[model samples]
Target chain A: MRPGISKILAACAAWGDKTAFLDCSGASLSFAQLHELSLRLGTAFRHMLKGATGRPIAVVADRSVRCIPVLLGAALSGSFYVPLDGSLPEARRRAMLAAIQPELVVGLAEGTSEAGFRYISVDELYGTLPDADELPPVDGDMPLYGIFTSGSTGFSKLVLKSYAALMSFIKAYIETFGFSERDVLGSQIPFSFDASTKDLYTPLACGASTLIIDKGYFAQPGRLAELLRDQRVTSIVWVPSALSMLSRFGVLGHISLPDLKRVLFVGEQMPVRQLNIWREALPDALFANLYGVSENAGNCLYHVVEKSYGEDERIPLGKPFPGTQVLLLDEAGAIIPPDQPDLQGELCIGGEILALSYYNDPEATASKFVPGPPGVGRIYHTGDLARYDEAGDLVFCSRRDHQIKLHGYRIELGDIECAALACPGVDAACCLFDPGKKKLTLCYAGASGEAALRTHLKGALPAYMAPGSLVRLEKMPLNANGKTDRVALARRYCGGGDVP
Target chain B: MIESNAMKEQIISILQDILPGEDVTESTTLADDGRIDSLAVVELVTEFSIAFDVEIPFSDLVNENFNSAEAMEAMILRLQQGT
Candidate 1:
């Protein structure tokens, strides 16, 4: 058996009848049940392997109790898993599926069909158990999963993670949190996001119960609060937007949840305004801010909130996780001297958790994942501009790319331009994010009002990308860098308002 | 009895409240007519569910049921009756 898979299966066995998963739809599975079912599913997948050992199996399941076992089942069967968010648009979903053409697509919902792929639903796999004695043995540094990240250029690239890396990340996470079998975890991120890795895997590894909430519930913060109360969830890992919405709508204040202990927020900056509300609401909870990208497997940095946070203090993204090394390097790739607070550089992460490379996109892999100084080996260029403060905490700055994150969704400026060019009235357009309102404002040289342009954009882009305000500009302002001066644009439209 | 015109006006008012910036009217189609996107529709549905006490399924979220303020009011009435 593969070393990681063997250890996880043994952990499941050791914790025997403990609850392993709680599907929000009212289904619960115990660790013993999960182990047996995983073995059966592994044997079933082995029969379908068609002699292609170590090949990845793509999974397109929503957040459910069945997702973890299916992942473990794939690992035990000597295959990897690639998760695709089924909620995405068909075109985007097809693009991702095509990039990582897998041996099988598992756990699709009824009447939902994607063309040009063979699939088996979870219902089919668990209907009958194969003889457990005949389960296949897993071996070697075979991949455990291939998680895709948005490419620096246009397309998305898959990052194949070895079983060793996955296990190492899981080990670090378990040790950091001191998680045990008694904890009940609440998962809010989609199965596709890297944040869900901890949500889905950590609980099963510790034989704890993971409560999978439906994505639709995320839009309604009230329902999310109700789910937390009803599920008796002891821990939660979610994006800051979810917490912000919860606090804004008073759901956190009104809800009565006595069991919640650990609250982990990531995927965006956690404003102190929002954190203050959370601190008051869940006075006993251990609130943690995690920082990382998909390239580092999962989180690489974490900061636990202090009991007595000063009013003037900005929350620091504390030191790196175990087995990870962080460095602040200038544009020339020289490491900045430690204790130099004024030195701002790109955040470069190096460690065991760094992804191997972008799948099939060597040019991009070379550009971002470059070799570090002589003895340091390869490091991931985070592209995030950051500087160490006098206190040794990393303070994040704007991205080198004009990628703007509004409401936790990453928006590339190029995507807005492409969408705008598709519109009828637009000759040329540039969209800028007003951080104050968390709104996208479209400044165009063409004839279109806020209404007409909004109507046009609704057809071209997703709801979030549609401009909230339209500003007409005779010509776009460009800086010395020959790029559109976004700072000038912000000054023009924002008009000295406080930036969000 | 809630008059048909009053129901439409009430629905439009609710939509206007939910989508703060827009100038929504009785003729505004929430979907393909492009007055609103999926996120706005979700917001409208949540408000409608709370105000009228009906559960709207995610799969049933389509342009046909919410083309106009009148259509949304009619859908809400239908849902209320079915319950």
Candidate 2:
């Protein structure tokens, strides 16, 4: 059996009547209750799969009490789970579901079904029991879950995580952070993203209680503050945008969350201005900046915010966890010496925390997960550019590709350009990222109105992935090689100028 | 306050510029029609705050106020008058 799920099962036995998960409406599932329901549901899954292999079970992972047990049940059935975003556009969600081609879709209701997949409602899964005597066996190396991330090539990619990789990271995380049963976690991220894995599994690993917050609360900062204050939520792992929203809305000045202790932000750079607002309000809380990718099983490095920072200054990635190795490689693939500290390199993560592989995409997997030079485990070549700062902290510089992180969501410039080209009356388009302004711009040479292109792009992409600004030019500038001159576009259209 | 029609036209122009292809009108449902998402909402708030010279606090950010350009115009007028 996989050690992580077993650890969770043991927590269920130990915690007994204590609440394991709670939703926004005060609906909850106790540890014992979750364990019992999941095992029975898992048995039903095993029977449904009939010992099928390599087919993932997709769950519409909404922020509700029902989703937790279904995810756990998928693991118990000796199958991995892929969490689909309930809030995404149907076209986008359909594209993701089609990419996975799941064996079964465990949805909230019965009417939801994709072609060639068996559909089972959460209620139906809960009601049925397997005829088998025991649950299916789980191997540690088997995939635990698959998450969808933005692909530079216009489509989404499925990143598969193994039971061993995630569980090992969880153990290392718990040991490094000193998490325990006394903590109450308020989860901020949706389960569809790998970032939510920390919130989903940490409670079980440390015998803690998790308050699964409502996504709607984010739109209302006052309500979110009240939930944190009332729930006495001691710890929270959130994206910088969430924290910045709360800070920008002055949520801290209106309410005081005395019980809040640990504040962790990941997925994007936490602007020091927003960090200062949070730090000034909650002086006692431990603030940490976490850095990692979905392929690295959550964060491999974290930096405890020890000193004050300027508003525009970039925060360091700090240090890696005990079991992880963060190495930098130069342009020629040579290891940049740690002592030099001046050379920039692609951030390569070396550790067991690396994911198993991209699901069914060996070519893409081989390009990233390469063998380490001498006696080291395989390293994940993160396309992120980085360099060690004077303080010896790993600081992020820029992306080697056109990949950009806005509001903690990854977006590829080419992805936006592809969606833009699909719009009627659009011919040529180029996407640019302005790091100074921290905004995305799309310049196109198309007859379609800017509003038309925005609407078309919105239908194809999520809100975060959409360009913040659009520019129309009579003709897109091109280089001698006939490629769109992206640098010239960035130089001209990057000052938040009027769209023309 | 600025002329009601002029303000509405300006708001439509802003929406058209930001959104690109929507048939935004005085009564178009911005939020319901998915023309204005969360990120777009932020852009709208910033544009309104700058153009109207009024602070559009998050508390005032509701679908009712932003569902239509007319609602946004009324909101701007109210905030402008209060100031």
Candidate 3:
């Protein structure tokens, strides 16, 4: 099959005059403009690389239209893009940069960037040359993009995905969903998140346009509803948490989103309570629960909410996409037969969905990516636990580890604790998430006051990773082995109170 | 409306109770600074409605009104005076 960038090339040929992207600020990029800019940036990268290719190019992913072209351009020139959230703590971004050691660093559209990395701009990319006659030949095996996710050790983990894997998933997703030139996808997911790729590339594959909804509009559900209606948005593939927030804000009934047809969600489990609200509001809309990770392009499992269920019932994780295989491996690494209904096993993903490896992390790559049972290919051991329901769909169970998914972000509790311990005057720390309250409460025993720790956390972790509220104690409760007693701490402070 | 300082003090006291361990200054940027989320906004609005006996409508829940204590108080005053 063709390489990942070829999809854009084909789109440029088919729908050059069509609007490919429309930013919330009323800025629009036609397919022709996107193609021309991508070519220019590719030529610029060629000049920068001189002869080098297959290098990592870091792009500070501030909310801007320039970011899309910059990413595709990097691939056009035979290099991969690493999209970073500009709002991340400098120290955290620095750690991520250190891991990738990107060939070039950039902030394409007034993108917020830090020092120590020689940065470039989109204008400079356009200035490279008038035009490049041809792009470098690329293979499906070539790295497409490497994305960083939260790590248990406080260091971000860069998961590198190949163009082949991305291409396969995108093709399957678009074909299955039947996205077309008539569809206007409302983009909400951040570029840093793997799922954002679905919103970015669906247009290229099917000649649709994506409305770059303002990130700030998420907190203001009324504005979000207004924008979706104004833009005539037909589809939305976003994290369930953001959808939950809008549902919680009660904006659906007030605003009419007649054109919004598809509501696809991934990242975390969509709360049935929140799902019901959306379902009730948009009675005719197709609501689907997508399941996958950064290891894949976006998702492999797609479950359409065709049937109604109680607010307490779960929406299944559904069957795999075309050409993808899913397995339930028991403790002995044997595949749990499909007929074994009530037994839970660790979910293993295989086929074209597997990523190349974790960038700069050999042990992590080795431990998670392993050979599958018998005819199945090498699989990625998703730390998530799953069970087969009577409907024959995979039902998600709890995670095997302490990693918790909050507001569509997968956070390792230890990462927060590690960052807290590094702060001045912090003796011991424990972070917990009350899913019901949707709050991250960090409890720390330290000489530093609440405000000081808050500042430190703000500068160290992303806003989602940072605890919304803090609980300070003179000393931490200890367990038998002299470890921080998380149970005692949870019992005292995290009992569903305001502090909790 | 009651005296400005007394009303502001009452708001601050309620905010502190809702968002403990946070330094709620007079000029604190609530929504803009990302200090307050939808949940916090809901809680604060509930408390303000109980204390001030004024219903803060959803339309008044924009960032400008919820940005600071003064902004919050101004909105409360408008709602109290039936503006």
Task: Report DockQ per prediction, comma-separated.
Answer: 0.10, 0.21, 0.18
Model 3 whole-model lDDT (C-alpha atoms): 0.78
Please estimate how well model 2 matches the true structure, expressed as its whole-model Cα lDDT. 0.78
For model 1 chain B, the run of ten residues with the poorest summed lDDT: B33-42
Residues B13-63 of candidate 1 have per-residue lDDT tens digits of 877765556666845555554455433554565566555667765334556
DockQ of 1: 0.10
Query: How would you order the candidates by TM-score, starting with the best?
Result: 2, 3, 1
Clash pairs for candidate 1: A2-A138
Using lDDT as the yardstick, the better of models 1 and 2 is 2
Off by over 4 Å in 3: A1-4, A109-113, A402-500, B1-7, B10-56, B79-83
Query: What CA root-mean-square deviation does each model show from the true structure?
Result: 10.6, 9.6, 10.0
Per-residue lDDT of B78 in model 2: 92
**Winning candidate number (DockQ):** 2
* lDDT to native, each model: 0.71, 0.78, 0.78
TM-score of chain A of each: 0.78, 0.81, 0.80
Instruction: Go through the candidates in order and give the clash count of each.
Output: 1, 6, 0
